[model samples]
Target: MKRRPRRSVPALLTALVLLATCVLLAVSAIQLILGERPWISYDTVAATLHDLRWTDVLPAVAGGVLALAGLVLLLAAVLPGAATVLPVDGSFHSGVARGSYRSTLQAAAAGVDGVSGARVKLRSRRLKVRVDTTRTRPDGLADAVRAAVTDRLDRIGPATRPAVAVRVRDPRRTS
Candidate 1:
């Protein structure tokens, strides 16, 4: 299977690139804001840079090169295919579909009486259910949710195995 990046990864990478750009900009800003020469003194630069010539300058040059490389990398991210957020199992859209399905299940679960919030997560087709429910567990709320989901799955036919998890996020009595 071909490897692919997650959809959010680009956004994340873009953010990282933005952050890198900000850092570079900050460095440039500092360079511009304070144009002071190196405190090493002109004599030091002349003395130190004179004898070794390019050799002594090599280290500083290398450091500058590295910084430039990092800047290039940040710039490359904007160009596409520079860095990809790999998806789990190389199937990003599948994961997104699963996520959306889980969200639907959660909403359905929340509709049950006594339930405040339902957060459902799917692990390889299995449903990990976390429901914020009021006192009494509302009796069989989990079952109801499970049945609804199973029915939907039957109609839709997911290509992966399914598991169900039910948890009570909160249990409180409400009039």
Candidate 2:
């Protein structure tokens, strides 16, 4: 069975906007057909919509649409072209479980302060998460990464010390 596509904030908001747009257009058409004077300003339109019991509806629909657009923009900014399944030089025979574990690591890495992005690559039971951070110098970054990853692992489950590797992959690019 094919899984249904998960509705993201943007997609959902777009749908709501479309529905609300249809309703507004319909209302406008109806008013035009009935020979009502056109509303001059948003205030008048809002007042009319309020009288027609659509005041709350308009705001709610507009807000949801705006919020969804913001979320989509944020995702695009944070992780552009991120693959659903990571394809790197790695071997995790445990299949899906291993992939999930690696994702967890990546999330943990991302949670660290100053870390812009991180990629947790698991291969042959070895784990490596390269941190793309704004650290000006290569001091205490390794320790900080280790501590963050360890804390996250402790919360995840039984503490099995995986071979933890962390390196600052993205330094401040002068160019």
Winner by TM-score: 1
> Tens digits of per-residue lDDT for model 2 on 1-175?
1122244655666678899988887777777778785433446777876676445677688889889878876775465342333323224321124557678878988888888888887754457889887767657777788888878766654223467889886566575
Q: What value of lDDT does candidate 1 attain over all alpha carbons? A: 0.61
Error of 1 at 44 (Å): 9.4
Give the per-residue lDDT of model 1 (tens digit) for 1-175: 2233344654676679789978866775676569854333446657865667554768778889889867875655554441122123333343334445566667767777777777776654467777776666456776776776666555545545477767665555578
Off by over 4 Å in 2: 1-96, 158-160, 170-175
Looking at model 1, residue 28 earns an lDDT score of 59
What Cα-based lDDT does every candidate model obtain? 0.61, 0.67
- What TM-score do all the candidates reach, one by one? 0.44, 0.40
Alpha carbon lDDT of residue 142, candidate 2? 70
Clashing residue pairs in candidate 1 are 5-85, 125-162, 125-163, 126-162, 126-163, 127-163, 127-165, 129-165, 135-172
